[model samples]
Target chain A: MTPNLLVFRVLRNPKVTISLSLADWDLLLRQARCSNLLARIHSLLNEQGLIDRVPPKPREHLQWTHVIAERQIKAVHWEVTMIRKALAKVGPIILLKGAAYVMAKLPPAQGRLFSDIDIMVPKDNLNEVEAALMLHGWGTTHHDTYDQRYYRRWMHELPPMRHIKRSSVIDVHHAILPETAAIHPSPDKLRSSACSLDGYDDLKILAPADMVLHSAAHLFNESELDNGLRDLVDIDSLLRHFSNLPSFWVVLVERAKDLELTRALFYSLRYTTLILHTTIPPSTMVAIEIGRPNQLTLTIMDKLFTRALMPDHPSCSDWLTNTAKRVLYVRGNWLRMPPLLLARHLFHKAFISPKPE
Target chain B: MNISTLTLSELGHRLKKAGMFLQTGTFITHLKTSIPSVAEGIRLLYADYPLVEHLDFADFHVSLTYPRNLRRWLKPQIQFLFDGKPPFKPLPADQAFPMLEWGLNWCVSSHANHYLIIHAAVIEKGGYAAVLPAPPGSGKSTLCAALVNRGWRLLSDELALIHIGDGRIVPLPRPISLKNQSIDIIQSYEPDAVISRKISDTMKGTVAHMKPPANSIIRANETAHAGWVIFPKYQSSVPAQLKKLSRSRAFIRIADNAFNYSLLGIKGFETLTGLVDASQCYDFTYSSLENAIETFSALEPPASSK
Candidate 1:
């Protein structure tokens, strides 16, 4: 672990904050804000009943972020409702990521803050869903011809849609990962196993095992490390909550193998345990070893993931953090597409396109 | 210690390296810059504000630095960085001071959710504050600057932070920002008032800042009750008319002008409504700053307010 990463130390043991001095809080709050985890820290402290122990000024920051996160959750609930209404006749609307956490009342939803709502529909119903949403004030945000073509042809999701009046955004997905990617998790399989949300008949969430696997896949495949720590925390919370269910680990391992997501699952388990001290059953650990990279790759990945997954704050970063981040960005793109297509996309973005406004 | 205690070279040296913690009303900004105008602006306008020691935490860590590109050499631009990220586009180097002011306001409005932040200027007299909520070109700042010079304590000239728990207006007095003719008007209005060098041709036309009164800075901890909610408009050749506005109308208007009213949800609605219920609401239009000051001077504290 990197030395003096107060945020990591607190995340590993929220109780340690009870012993920190005001100066330590000065750094901790700044690091948490930079990492986009201030509300998460606030929720952690509140869960343990340690908020009052924090000094007044630092507590205000935590409290302020709590206000924002609370507002965001309320907004998400309204947005999800409007989306369900928009797609009522289309098909089942399976909420993903942040929206899913809130709808399912998962542990990570306590203070999660996210900008967009993600939902997955059947591939056959994509056109109907798009038309329905457009009729309800949501408009496609992208305008460039090539960019639009790339999303329509290759990406898992359509170009992100935003409401004309409210400016709220939604990402409509037909699958979990890009069609061009190495892993080909079947959208039908995920849809068939989704569980209906409590009050709504049309609203559904990914089954527990698939939820963990999808979070793992999404986090490990991302190039942008700005929210790397926050996403990892989600995986950790999901694992801890779902492990209580009967046969969850066994089902999770089987699902990962079946879905070709074992590599992402392996990395998720390894880092969650290493960084957040998450506990995994001994047998489950042995079962996931099949997905582990070779010794050399494991060593290199440990160096990169450990650094890249820390808060993107100067206090949590070292000299090689930038290099590790850059390498991971390239690796993320490489993992998402064929070499030729990836090259074409990068070239056009760099030279031919005007930068996004 | 205050900024006036530091010589220009010492102030510039600190700003160039470790930065200084400048206390303005309820928040302290750890400010850094190599731009002489930013440093000079602080030395001139913020001379009376307290300088917090290094051991305490600052609410915002901000800096104005030149962008590292050919643009830095071609036309010369300055960027405002909150923490390590730039929240705004680079402006002309000469507008560096105003950029810092705007950046600091952004920091407060965007992050300070502990209070119900309104896009209004607030001034207090005899423990009663009048909240001036208006859009740009409404002559809000001009009237605020004139009122402060005439005896009202400047709570803030941009954001009015109403405490959520108790409806008290938290004082956040800083340098009063003046634009275009108001700059010249203020200079001739009070010849002894310290105003910064004006920078021209920027987004808000020409801009300058008048030093806040030292008395207001010394009384930074004082909080005031809301006495009035006045929306001011600068209409040419108009009489100084102060007309009563319905409380419901004032409530909606104040919420509309707030930076995070909707974000605060029910709590924002409650706080704003409570402020309206406690204060007299009015729509004031005036062509002359002198007449505006005379009208504001006659406001009385609400009977129910503490």
Candidate 2:
């Protein structure tokens, strides 16, 4: 294997420890991100002191590659705290992706790397909770109140917002799919089948079956290359984590049927498997996809999605432009919402999109 | 074939050797399998973790089951957990993380529970805890990891437990994460800090863990009164800044950020309301970790007398 490929191979092994010089790992990170994302990463490394500190115990203190993992653990811890605090207060929050995996208490960064937390809440509590957040230090960054109202009214989720104190942006979503999806379920029905985390008083989230479908929907619904391997990672982790329960697959298919999200799920499975080289069982994979997806559609989406994940992906702009036109065409059919309503929803997202500052 | 994309059972078979079962709330995680080989992927990933004993469960079978698909990535983990096993090939750290993460999720979420779990980052200092709840790129984790290194106690880099009865912050102190460049910044700050092995190509950028401070671990279950309700953001080259937030906005933010806020309905509302009311709210922004440390440490915690 090439040197880079060697690193990839070493990473592929769960047991192999190819420890690099701690400083070497730090240098590689600089090359790993775009200027914008890299700046933020460097600050975090400086703060966590990963650049300065070598591994302490275990006699492998010099390996900075392993030390690089401190960032992953930090992210998991941050995501988990959000889930726990919510669970502690109102009820158990339905955790998704990285947060859920991390809270289960594995090595902090060993789970998935999620970009933003996607959480669902009881629909009735949406506004009440939004109000509650406004009162705390998290403020609405967007100024248009109508846009905010549009989100609460039409979309399943609110626009993201920035924290007044912390400036952290957050997406307070009430639903998973937007009203625009060509094939989708009503928010009300999705909420009905949602599962409640038992540790809480009355908190709940989209059911596991629904969650998987939603994951698929998120992957297939949009222009497809916004977030990188994350959405796929979510699907991969969700399927594996829930696979032990024989009923999970069966329920997933059924839920997809009910929600009309099967097509997306099918495409997602077909493409993720082909491109990322995901290893779903042939039986389960077939069941998940029914007949195989069109090779062309799968390839296009897969290539686009793959590019989105790579920070230094060479053709990002061209890919994104092409993806945008396709995305709009898809959006036109999926969403039957009026232009006015769509306008309102978009407005809500701009203002309500979660922000920490 | 890349083992990461494999299914959970496949991984179980490949890495099956030794393990244990960990159950909490609606989650059930089996660790330390009899085969011992399965533990290889995760053992090294979590090698530094302090094991705890629970006398409550003797009835269930204890076996290790990771997201079977993740066995290949978890090879290093096996060596971390198994001391006497023959030397095995270890995968890159990040590749193994997903399988370990998948296994942990099954363990925690599968266990029966009474709390509505969420995904977030929590940190406490001087009896005042700040909960940073966000999705990727919100800079919540980056800031939380930084805070813990500087004097603020790491309640948890990921999950925080709020007492259902009184809305107090419960500690689940664990490692802080730094991704890509952030990993180096943290090491330079405290070279002696215990960080986990690095794993690249995760959902987030290259990921790493900052061993949570010892004090946070010793007081893992300690409760701290909600002091200032401040959310943090790390914008490069941005000077440190803080500002007040409105009540209505705070309500929305907290409710949105909360995992189970609405699950508790009136109770959740009351608890959240009380938290915001008792704590002075602010939105803080900074680019420098040093400034962040100085900024937080300089803040006067909510008056204890109040």
Candidate 3:
């Protein structure tokens, strides 16, 4: 893979940004902005103490992104509190992804900006939870009959709910993957292992190993490549932080096999290492080989994933990059449902529904 | 070199090729377009703005282009591309120039959080600046254009960029956008004032741009300490009047007019507090530009004891 994009190069080693000229800084800022990782880059630079070395013009952009992320951090906290209050009587609420990271005070939460607050509830309580949330000002944003039916019948989550007054969105999920998906990691198992937050009896996050696998599964199975790079960074962060615990690698690999998510784990490890240069032990790499695809399939998948994971900017793309993204988008859909259902859904999305942003 | 130095064809060629890096105030934008009207508008209105070298870093990389579909012929529209992505929907092709102006304003207000950006018109005389914060149809632009033409230096006609650290107003003098009768009023008020051809039926009504004074463009970097926060209301047939406004009241009102006040949070509050404390606030109402100019010119700086 050509690793010549300034934003990627700087991400791989942020110290390199210290020497970037004004023109390079311009490209870096634009590329990072497009990738939704500008604040992540700024945080990395600050961690390395290299922020002071950046030129003033680029520094201003970084500063602006930092301010936005800072504001988001506060907002996420308030939003999660409100969501908890709204869903107080429903059942145990497991914060997921960005909201989980923020509540858990994980490394990945720093400088991250997320639009929706995601939480997982027990499968049996999904209805009660949705109704309670609606009582507290959250309403379904999707009005299309097809979309509503598709999400309710085939998806793991309800149609996304938005607050009337605040305009913040909440995605209520019962499981990590769709009901029709090929692999079924039991939501019961994930909920059983969920760890409670300090001083909060009902509020929980996925156990350390489950969190990593869920991120892996979500990144590999999701079609939205706009945040693909940001999601990968989340996995890298999760691994780096989790690896400090005793026997984390052993538990992670075992959990993936038990959940039937080893393939997602394999792709997560391979790409995070290849793209972000995330470190994994040799033994763990060998252990994950059990989930690896055949040689030809592996080669083809690598080409597609690498090109699609690039910053969504023209400067980072070649002629084949778009084709790679299109293929992966279709692959993401195919993994979620049966062929007939996928076809119907895609058709409805293309022609029947008004376009979504 | 200023854009005026380039011949029209040469400017168009360069713009259509590598784009022109035009510097306005602290920000530089790389502008590219194939449309003659867009080029013509820039040539006429941006004549005094300096041109940066092509290789220099620009704050925004923008392009105005014909949409690449049947719409190019079947209704004809222009899209403003910022960093190759269109943030706004396409508009009628004739509105290309106004679209650029609006697009540029969006680029600043949305991203330039390094300053406390307010939606107001600011102009300077002597060493002190006056910020005119008002709603649309308030005749703020008309008043600003008249004041600038009468020897006041234009700071900006839309965005008021106040430095967050020092509370100094940054000069971003560009074209003064006039709407409806204000366009004709300014045209007659200063017959020598260079105004662009009027474009009608915009999101805002018939809009024309009055070129900023060359002196204001030349002194673009000269930041000024804001001395007056004047809310101008254009009430027809009212005698020109200026009433004192409480600094506390001015702070809340100006905060309401700011684009990024809430986004900036505490720092925005502190910067605006400094601005309000340093400036004397007033509510000014006027009908005639002649009486308005006289009232503004007669204003004095606040006593240092306060």
In order, what are the TM-scores of chain A for the candidates?
A: 0.98, 0.65, 0.97
Q: Global CA lDDT of candidate 2, please?
A: 0.53
Query: What lDDT tens digits, residue by residue, belong to model 2 across residues A227-296?
Result: 4334554575566567776777778777787787777778666655543345666666768665345789
Candidate 1 local Cα displacement, residue A224, angstroms? 1.7
Query: For residues A1-357, what per-residue lDDT tens digits would candidate 3 score against the true structure?
Result: 746778878878998997888988889989999888999998998988999998888898899889899889889989988988987887679999999899888989877889899899888888899999999999999898988998899999999999999999999999999998988999999999999998788799999999999999998998768798889989999999999999999999999999999999999999989988889999999999999999999999999998889988888888989999899888989999989988888898889898877
Query: Mind giving the per-residue lDDT tens digits that candidate 1 earns over B1-306?
Result: 788999999999999999998888889889989999998999999999876668568889899999998987689999999988899989989999999999999999999998999999999998989999999999999899888888989999999999998999999989999999999988898888889998999899999999999999999899998899999999999999899999999998998899999989899999998899999999999998888887887776787544
lDDT of 2 by residue, B140-192 (tens): 77778777767787776555455555777766554466678877777786787
For each of the candidates, what fraction of the native contacts does it recover?
0.69, 0.00, 0.59
Model 2 regions lying over 4 Å from their true place: A1-93, A104-116, A186-199, A202-206, A291-296, A309-311, A315-357, B1-306
Lowest summed lDDT across 10 adjacent residues in model 2 chain B is found at B78-87
True contacts kept of 1: 0.69
Of models 1 and 2, which has the larger lDDT?
1
Q: By TM-score, rank the candidates, best first.
A: 1, 3, 2
Rank order by lDDT, top first? 3, 1, 2
How large is the C-alpha RMSD of every model relative to the true structure? 1.4, 20.7, 1.5
Q: Using alpha carbons, what is the TM-score of model 3?
A: 0.98
